[model samples]
Target: MNANGPVTAPPTTGPPEHPARAEIDAEENLLEKRRRLVLRRLKQFLGMAVAGTLLLLLNDLLLVHSSAAPSLVVTLGVFFTALCLSYQGRARASLILLITGVLATVGVVLWLEQGIRDSAAVMAMTFPVVVSAMAGSRPLFFTTTALAALVLMAVALGDITGLHPHHVRPVRLSALISLEVVMLAVGASIALIARDLRHALHDAYQQAASAREARRQMEALAFLDPLTGLPNRAAMAQHFEREAARASRDQRRLGVFFLDLDNFKTVNDSLGHPAGDALLRQVAEALLSVVRKGDVVSRIGGDEFMVLVPDLQSDLDVPALADKLVKRLTQPFHVDGASVTATCSLGIALYPDDGHDFAELVKRADTAMYHAKNAGRNALRLFNEDMNSNVVEHLHLLNGMRQALEHGRFELHYQPQINIRNGDIVGCEALLRWREPGLGLIPPSRFIPAAEKSGLIVEIGTWVLQEACRQIKRWDDAGLPGITVAVNLSSVQFKRGDIEQVILNALDSARLTANRLELELTESLLIEDSERFSGLLKRLNELGLTFSIDDFGTGYSNLGYLNRFDVDRLKIDRSFVHDICTDTHHQTIVRAVVQIAGSLGMAVIAEGVEDQATADKLLELGCELGQGWLWSPALAADDYAAYVRQQGRAAPA
Candidate 1:
């Protein structure tokens, strides 16, 4: 199943029954064998013909007193030498020599001695028919047979008149007629047999060819993707292995890229699968067009492809190539009469640099690809040592998160959100903090994204919502000042279509009023289709639950949604706040956001106020609510309760 070796279909040549080469090669072998068989038999028969003719000439010279013996012997010797010396494997040359030797020796003796009355000369003509039959050529057999009959008839006419050299007796005339009739019957039969044999060979070759074609089709199915007409993962694996070895031997660089189409599932879900398929085909063609002739591009799985860059000039050039390929793939594709653009993230690893072998290289490339996706899609990353360590850390964090959730090793910290005008802790954002068994106090930044990507965010987010609700309800029952407790929700949670139910369940189980709980969602969440998500927001709002737009002014926002939906507050992103004191643009954006909120009759909260100057500017800007280290860092539930009690007591009565 690991196809990282040579996957190209090799040219086939050999016997028909070879499992790899199949029937075409076998048919070729059969033809060669037949040709060699005919050549060998023809040589042996020619030697016999020469020896037989010499014996006949010697008999005529020593005993029969045949005057044509000398000329016939000389001609037969010359033709026999030519046949033995010149006919290598050419059946045509052998056949021609056979006919020439037979006619010259037989005709000379027949005309010089008894013409058509000579039985020996007539018998000598039959050898050529046998040789021609064995050559497996029907046309040659028929031609040789017809030539022998014509010569015999010519001799008969010469013997008919007194002008003939030998006298034709009536007793001998009937015997010569019988011999000629038998020769014609034998020659005709051999020709018919050769013709049938040729047909049978032709039929067999055709059958073998058909079977080979079928096998080739099966191989194509096994190794290629039908939709893209590209090699599959199995083929890619095979190609990688072979190229790796060749690269090592030749001291060449080989680059392997792990590529994944970004947001392809959204296209499939929004459009139809047929559109997605057409888009994939277009992508494959684009990728192939951008790569080198020696490079291989394969579709390993859904929305995932690999490009094997063999014979690279240098490992340093891989990034440039990868970038070019990514750019090519991101071009707009016209599918189903609609213009659609899909980008890809690629991770590249070179042979002997990232890994010495296929598996190792692919693993590194895959790791790097994940990093590229995390960094943001439509990019490429070359494998590095840090990526490996990050991979290890990510895996450790992912595994630890699962166990932490199960054993209640995770806890929530409350960061106080104070009313800037009155200096009262109006509410607190419930932030998640993890304390692993050994690794203490893991930040939300480190594991939150990982959890979301791994789909553990759904469970983790649910726990956060429920635990925060329960803790706040306990605070209320203990007679402490009640404040709105906000739990941040990941965009992934909303995708489940059951986020509203989850929120209701947490509030009901905690016996807390819906109005006391606030759910925070990022600006990206609002960027989604308003019609699809607006209903859920309205339903949640009907339950007296409120919402805040978190990390505002950091992403593309349809600011109209703030008013269209029941948004109560906007938390200015920390990036703008961190630089607001120094950067005019940040200050202007903050002022604009505050103005926009005030016009819409919504509360605005600014976070990351580390100093009094920044806090004073927010107050001057009409921002009412804010939280930062200026108050205190986020605290555990018990610590937060103590802090709240302490702050209440210190307030002037």
Candidate 2:
């Protein structure tokens, strides 16, 4: 018993619920007790029948009375009938009747015999114990032995009190009590042994169940990624190999996507580690929110997740997935007290075209992701070598632009932000143009997207902010104009948390009012960290700095989301403007974009107005501003200022 101390009948702590399992276990326990109760009653009844027979034999041997023989015989007949009934069923009622008959007969026989130690009455005392053991009920055997002992003691005490005296001598009384004690002691020992065996069996079953539960928990832990509760690398790889094999045999297309969160580390740095972890979980949920039941999403590494699309075909169905994922990520996430914003760049590598093997497919997807990161954050790009060459050239340009930023080859040009109705210059977007000593007058598009990819836009954008501030300060000093200089924001620049501080730094340096500088972003930029990005915009927006989304229709084009953002103008994309004069389809699209922007109280600027026809049509369509080669392409800072001066002289009042 010292194995854990006296195996204290393990407390039934039950289970942890208001609806405990005790009632259930207890009901099973009661059933067994009731079954034993029936067995016990039958054993007692059989014992009584045996006693009645033995008593009749002794009474016949001692007396020559036919009356006593018939009385004993009648008692025997009654007990025999009871034993038959008890053996068949109704053990409780039949056995109780047998017990009452035995006690009364024993007392009456003793009084008639003057308390002699007769075989007749003594037989009744042994019958219950002997028959209980024969019937295989150890508890009943011990209980019967105890009851017999008590009955013998009562007879002995009755004799002493002279009330229905049946005891004759001290020796007879001592002998009967001694026999009863011996029988009880032996029977109780057997019962104690049986109870111990039953308890040991119960303990073994519980231990086996506990071990099985522990095993299941360990197996689950092996598959789970602890932080996000998504599948880990090993589980994901095993799934990949299984699905890849199935797809190969079935001739189904498989899509492997490598998703990297854009600038997630910035949130970790700014908001502390706990907030970062919460943000990551929120992102994981958003990524999988629309996933169907059979699809799988896994966290492969820090800030990188992998998706396996097992059955796919690349028509309208497959190409549509990339656009939907991009849209899902643009919605702002709220965690803790902060409304966090995040975006993911998706890179796709199709089966067989990318690779027949898992490792090869993953590598190609990784290669595609590098190209997507080169394009900009919040964008998706498929794997192709031609895409990489352009990606390589763009990165090279940014590396050169970094060197140029330090040596000073960057210059800004001002293009008029004009009123379409009057054709008067209202404000100007300060555009950057480069004149490298080796290459003359390089365009902004070739270098700007590169600057964004390389994260050099934050610095270059800061330069533009300060330059525009300085120029507007100069114009005010000359009393030539007091107008806003709208500057374009690259996506990378939009990601910076310190964008407001960058503007504040510029405004303080150049001594220009915050009201005179406007920040413009593409609609694609609106799709990233809008909570963080929009907060930065609103801070500047609150300072009277204007906000506009450039290339509006070229983005995901969710006009519903556009109304939720803080902006002053929506610049109609140049692609639409280029074809609006020729294509009726393009005209319809332009009209829709213009109507939506105007309905939201955001002024529409028509970009790429290369001829009078395009500008006149934009004005006819009720656009508020136009900018393109119709007037001038982006120019050098000094040259544009001198040209503006010359244009003012050429103007007729």
Best by lDDT: 1
Name the TM-score of candidate 2: 0.43
Tens-digit lDDT track of model 1 for 445-542:
98887777555688899999999889988887877746678889998898853788888899999988888888898878877767767888888889
Candidate 1 weakest lDDT stretch, 10 residues: 1-10
Question: Model 1, which residues run further than 4 Å from truth?
Answer: 1-206, 217-239, 242-354, 359-387, 496-498, 578-585, 611-613, 648-653
Q: Which tens-of-lDDT digit does each residue in 254-325 have in candidate 2?
A: 777788888689888988887877777777776676454456777787888877777764333333455456
The model with the greatest TM-score is: 1
TM values, all candidates: 0.52, 0.43
> What C-alpha lDDT do the candidate models reach, one value each?
0.77, 0.67
